[model samples]
Each structure stands twice: as C-alpha cells, then as structure tokens.
Target: MSKRTIDYYTKIGILTPERSESNYRFYGEDSIETLHLVSQCKEQNMPLAEIKEKISLYYTSSVEKEKLLKYAQVLSKRMEHLEAELKEIKPLLDALNEEEQKSIINRMSPQSMALAQSLIILFN
Candidate 1:
C-alpha cells in the first residue's frame, strides 16, 4: 500500500501504523485487520460515524466476544430487513428488461433508489 493510503486510514482512526527508528510507518497485523474491516464496512455502505462508534466500542470493552455478538445481532437485523425488501422488490426488478430498469432507476429519487442499485450490484 502507498503512504497516502496508510495516511488515509490513520486519519480515519481505522489504523495506527507504528513508525520505525527512521520514521518509516510499519503496519502490524492488527492494523491490517482493522483496515480490512473498515473497508468492508464502507463497501456495505455503513455510516462512518457508526463504524467509528463500533471501533471505539471494540477497543474500550473488556468482553470482546459479547460486543462482537451484539454487533452480529445488529448486522443480522439489517440483513433481514434487506432480505424483506429484496423479496418485495425482486419481482419489480425482474419484470423490467435492462433498458427499462435503467429508465426506472433514473426516475427514482436518490435516497429511495440507491440501495436497490447497490443490491443489484452486490447480487450480480
């Protein structure tokens, strides 16, 4: 990874790479794992504020397993909701041909339609 990428992660508090004697940043396994987690969270369109809160919770808690279980519960609920939405939306999505889908998407409001587009990309 480039210095800029490392710096970006540091700025977001997702990583804290240690500096060597010559001031060269070196990321450890923990930092690399954190970067992967943060990237996955972003890819899932999780809010940065929520990610930050979760990261802080992870660090400050003694019962790490319990905290992770709670986080899993939250993620499961989100997955359930998305699945429900997909069940409802799939027929509509399937009914349209490619051009029609594009046209429908263009007419939809951004907030209402973005998740559908993301789900399409994710599932495809």
Candidate 2:
C-alpha cells in the first residue's frame, strides 16, 4: 500500500502504526493483515465507513479476539528473540551428538517444551 494511503488510514484510526522517537511510523503484521482485510472489503464494493465499522466489529465483538491478538503479538516478539538466540547457538547444537541433543531436550522444563511446540505450530 502507498504511504499516503497508510497515513490516511492512520488518521482515521483504522490502521494504527507504532511511532518512533523520530516520529516515523512502523507498521507490523497486524497492520498488513488489516490492509488485506480493507482490500477484500473494498473488492466487495463496501464503503470505507462500513469497512471501518466491520473492522471495528471484528476486533471489538469478542474479548477472546483481543486477548488472542495480544498473545500473538507477544509470541511474535518472543519468536524473533528466540530465533536470534538459536542462530547464535546453532553451530554448537549441530556439533552435539544425538544423545547430547536428547539429553538437552530432557533437561528442558515441560512448559518450555510446550512453548517451543506452540511457536512451531503457530508459525507453520
């Protein structure tokens, strides 16, 4: 989408982007997804006001949706951090034998294992 269009959307409170200290706006996955939704609604000949209302309804109609969005954002950040850490340790991990790998896995807490599995499922 064009920067002008995004600025317009932000002005109308439809596509909120994070603002930096320098006043630069940074759009994330949610904004991209919102853009896709707006495009689809427009393709269906929906008016912009109606599209805005629909988007608001989709977001506000359910508490679960709000919570899920928050969780997803948190998980996305965690995944990014974990990816960096994994990149640093990847060579070390590759050097380990199968038994060593299994031992490391066995030493991890169940919650960590579950979180890793959930992240795998979420991204895939």
Candidate maximizing lDDT: 2
Go through the candidates in order and give each one's C-alpha lDDT: 0.76, 0.77
For model 1, residues 1-124, the per-residue Cα lDDT tens digits are 5778778768887677799999988888878777677777787788776676577666674757776788788777876788678878789888989999889778978865877667667755
Please report the TM-score between candidate 1 and the true structure. 0.51
Q: Residue 76 in model 1: shift from native, Å?
A: 6.1
The 10-residue segment of model 1 with minimum total lDDT is 55-64
| Candidate whose TM-score is highest | 1
Worst 10 residues of 2 by lDDT: 115-124
Superposing all C-alpha atoms, what RMSD in Å does each candidate have to the true structure?
A: 7.8, 14.0
**Candidate 1 — what's its lDDT?**
0.76
Report the lDDT of model 2 for residue 68: 58
Model 1, runs deviating above 4 Å: 57-61, 64-77, 93-124
How far off is residue 42 in model 1, in Å? 2.4
